[model samples]
Target: MPVSRVASRFAGIEESPTYAILDLAAELRARGESILDLNGGEPDFDTPGHITAGGTQALGGGFTHYTPSRGLPALLEAIGDKLLKDNGLSVDPARQVIVTPSAKHALFLSVMTLLGPGDELLIPTPSWVSYPAMARLAGAEPVFAPLSTDNGFRLTRENLEERLTPRTRALLINNPNNPTGNVLTATEAEAVAEVARAHDLFVITDEIYEKVRFRGEHLSIAALPGMADRTLTVNGFSKGYAMTGWRLGYVAAPEDVSAQMLKVQQHTVGCAGSFVQRGGISALTGPQEPVEEMRAAYEARRDLLVEGLSGIPGFVCPSPDAALYAFCDIGGTRFADPAAFTTWLLREAKVAVTPGFAFGPGGERHVRLAFATDPKTLGEAVDRIKTAMERL
Candidate 1:
């Protein structure tokens, strides 16, 4: 048999910058370099004890096997209940939800299922890096609609309208967005729903950071009037429950759309881990204090990092209201761009931060640093950065 050629879909898809930075940090750490990492997107806190216990109980009870292609029955019900309680969307779990190994996986499933060649997915700029790649891998074109700092990085209808074309088939929304941490306001959510309705476009809303918000109430586009039938809501236990390693997340969509997504889930990654699904049930239904505590900690860290970055001579940072990143504008800095600034910091300050261009358009002059770790460590990074700035 001839050796199989690599698929073209893999071309131009770089490793996620978050993971790439992590791998680089690991290699430096192995070589005895003290790298203060602020490049991760996961919570530094441990997974809540009760959720761990739930998985342990299931494992002990011999739940170590494949679940139904969609997900475990009870787990799906728990997710449905969570949607109603937290997101205000009523769903029939059996037909509307599919568990995947991670929120990223669920997103991949969605783009693969709904998009194809020549179709365009309108993504707000500075999005999580995987979104555009997911669309591309599915043979669709990703059209980035740049969200400006002038608008506080909010997704406006005007932005979407300008990007729309005959081939635009879907929109990917990340609320409490990753790099910017801009939570969608009620008005913006309505704008999204309005455009979605006007264009009859399928909507994929990534709400993984819902629990990590610091500002306004998190609203789901699916919960808005006329949006339930067209929106795919994606959430996971990674940021909120510190379950990144557990690799558990889910997508809830209309039954018809979910049915197609299930075919993708069924063929690729059969289901989330059986016992992991048990853990997810506990994550959704269990006490949410840990999630709150983590959010509070991140809020404090955001303030610290933002204040520090602002004081630095050439950096302008906005206080992010959600998620773990502080996107700082470094265009005024002496270094040419975010990449140069990040490289300088890593070499001189012994710290790691993500270059913002990895996140796509509108991130050209910035760098994103995660506030996911402890205050002391963050303080140290700030000091190191300050010192590095002074020495230069």
Candidate 2:
């Protein structure tokens, strides 16, 4: 009997490393083992009451039909206002916004629209794992651009220019970056915009973690002069509004690019859920106290985990400026790599964490611990890590 085979393009990529570790942690919990999870990146808080109430109201009002291929006009207008008021990026609701299932989907649609055979995308190292895979899925090659740790994981004009090729079609960056949680300074962001203009390249700025900052102000690269036309701004409700289960995200791009991306959206997943989008409208326009409360809680957890790990021998925990993660260096430890150390830590300490290599190069001998949990849990995980270090 002949068996069906998967496509050739998918053969090169594997599952997301973060979720794989999460599955292992789940299995341990099923077996009645006491496992501490520091691997998942989701916020522990629930969606606010007002937002859920909006969804309920929409359902009762018979808002279950499919919306416009782009999105509901009211939601689009609200997002446009949000981009202008909060991000300083002005966009047209009628032609520049498309609500999607998740931020990840918005990214995939953008990649497919901008990249094709023989095109290349510049992705900074230690980025979220999905960017490279999305590029490959669009039949484009992903080129890695190395960032300096001493420079606080920012992309300098020189390093970015060196990686540019004639085939380069676009550049992608995540502000308040994943894993490292380092926010780009105003000067650094201007340098990136300058490089993009000089090389005539498009930019995709993922500002999903913009609201999770602790010490720096969030600015959109698209707001810079001449960048609004060439940059695609991606944001959503998952991280900022604690509405991950609702799965709502959106992209603001130039009119033409938005049209192309709509074609992709029209064929797949058509439109974001009607009721969920109403919930998103409430999330954007309603009271923001819940968002602030969640941010404050994450900050406390971040401090607890980072402070506790600082005293562990051979471990160096940097103070993260934003996001719910702490990417620590384990280079001083005896382990050969982060994967080996993670395996040992899980078996001996009963704590699960994401290995650094999963992010990209420049992440060797490091691990990313998500602090999106309660303070007591984070404290316990820290103590367990200390004990595991003593054994090592």
Candidate 3:
């Protein structure tokens, strides 16, 4: 027998459950079976034309070398302008921001730079699958504060306070959250801000889905009173601009933290792709008409998916006000175990979804279906789901 050589950091972290679903779907595909995939968080749209052109232009114009690790000057300036205009934040582009390969990278950088052994990072679940994994990788304890399913998984100050301990150093938030598509209302954002204030906790908020909003204004916690200095804001062009393959995102943090993350960037990947950074600038500052149009399409798809799911027997789905997923409760169904239900959907319904336990505590009896596909495909998925339920 070979010696087990995996390090302790890899102990509790299994492969990402989201990716595991993708892997399973791939296996079914390999066997030549039809699979209706509703598991990915990626947008189903093309990158806006101007943004692609911007990247091509940069490449053709000989901007293919390593950029400053912090990012190109123009892109940083555009990001700064965006924060001031859209998020009510004013930041110095040079000292406060670092562009990375993706929002996931920005998160990894933030986690690695800010956390260490014995420190606690507060995560409110049902959270994105990566939050706890990132905390664990940083050698920090991930304390999950599960939001109540009774209240539509809404964020409340009490859930966070209940999980607080002396070792707690930070809170990570994702607005217009993935898996559950719940956008934080003004009151909820304030609840987070208040908790952060009372405990002196730094906040690392992921706003990747900010522009995909379908309801009230998306608020940035950093824009709240007394939060500016203690918040690290991460945003990217993946969801909104449909540039997932571009692998680009940026983090706006306190200057010192930005410096430390920059060091991590220098050692790992050096800089983001030169051309992608240029495209990011265009995505931020170019024509926003495509953004508006795509959002309208997503809004329509959300309505369709929600209505369809609501019609299914024993399925309870709240219309997500923003983002690309429909988080549904299957607790009332005959196949009440989310893991078992997920398998049944794949085997019988030929429909694939992520089990809710993949997200965290309160999501146990649910499953998340991404609505990023075309309306026809989404409709078929819903029909398949209903048929599967009827036979059960």
Candidate 4:
């Protein structure tokens, strides 16, 4: 029998390119191909022993039951203290924070809570692949405001002004952004905040990579005056604490919005894992030496990869100041399409990288190389990339 007709909301959505490449690499590796995977966004470091021990203690203490829809009070309090200490932002543990399965889930919750059919979300181009798709899933239109390579992919006040419309309901900002690794300055962030305030739009800021900055400090738009009430800040332990498998994230928003999001969470995920929440408590309260060590390693890899890629003919490699990615331009070269170039590199160089076209329209001529792998693997991948460029 034929299946029931699928919903129209899913018509425009497609598989995530990051995972698609990962699957392909896994298949090729199963066939004995020496694949060097640079397509991942996860850090290579293992979760800290203390964090793992905390999870173990929770399990042994028989704390596996369902938690409150919002989160454990202790975890929320820890997160509140962390926000104040790290980002200079204040949040009420009982009213403002809701722990979710992951930051990706937090984004979905924000969209569902604040958006609907007639609403619009203003997103910067060459952004994380899920932003527009998530907006579509929530029955909102996603309007693109393209950031230029000439501007280091940083959004400006003019960029925000040009994209504002009557239906614009929110603006999404990802600092130390994915794929592009662009971190906005405090001045630029305040300018964007000004536009959001003028348009009366909710600002959903993803600071998942806040701890991954290299050249300068990380700033939060939520900290700006008049923004705390309108901004929903989403972050988690995945990127910063090497806890991707833990699937722990949280959102801090105005009390009223946070209340509504708790209802959504009750019907949806119900709550993040209880034991995992315990581990998250430790992640927030524990010593941050592991975080710093991981960041230092990523910095070294970034330097090596950027320096190596810069030597390739017909390639333009920009030094990323934050995040663990090096987005390179491959236009005016032998390759014509980013997707095609990625496929060719995987087959010829046995190195896996993400195609830039998956990021957004403005990423068509570029590709993203992850520096989250080990130094030895990254060095080998660079050598292979150089050889591949020579072949082209």
Write the residue-wise lDDT of candidate 2 on 193-307 in tens digits.
Answer: 9999999999998989988889888889999999999999999999988888999999999999999999999999999999999999999999999999999999989999999
Candidate 1 lDDT for residue 303 = 93
TM-score of 2: 0.97
User: Candidates' lDDT values, in order?
Assistant: 0.90, 0.90, 0.91, 0.90
Query: TM-score per candidate, in order?
Result: 0.96, 0.97, 0.98, 0.97
Best by lDDT: 3
What's the CA error at residue 87 for candidate 1, in Å? 0.9
| Worst 10-residue lDDT window, candidate 1 | 16-25
Global CA lDDT computed for model 4: 0.90
Instruction: Report model 4's TM-score to 2 decimal places.
Output: 0.97
lDDT of 3 by residue, 1-392 (tens): 87669887888888877676677788999999899999887888999999999999999999899888889999999999999999999899999999999999999999989999999999999988889999999899899999888888899999899999999999999998877888899999999999999999999999999999898789999999999888999999998889999999999998888888899889988999999999999999899999989899999999999999999878899988789999999888887688888888898888999999999998889999998999999999999988887887
Model 3 lDDT-worst window of ten: 16-25
lDDT of 4 by residue, 1-392 (tens): 87659998997788887676777788889999999988878888999988998899999999999999899999999999999998889989899999999999999999999999989999888889999999999999999988888877878899888988999999999887887888888878998799988888899999999888898778888999999999999999999999999999999999999999989899999999999999999888898999999999999999999999888887898999899899999986789788888888898999999999888867888999999999899999999988987876
| Model 3: CA > 4 A from native | 1-3
For model 1, residues 1-392, the per-residue Cα lDDT tens digits are: 76549887777577876565666678788899999989877678889999999999999999899889999899899999999999999999999999899998999999999999999999998988888888989999999999898877887799889999999999999988989988888989999999999999999999999888899899999999999999999999898899999999999999998999999998898888999998998998889888888888889989988988899998889888888999988878787677777878887888999999999999988899999999999999999999999999
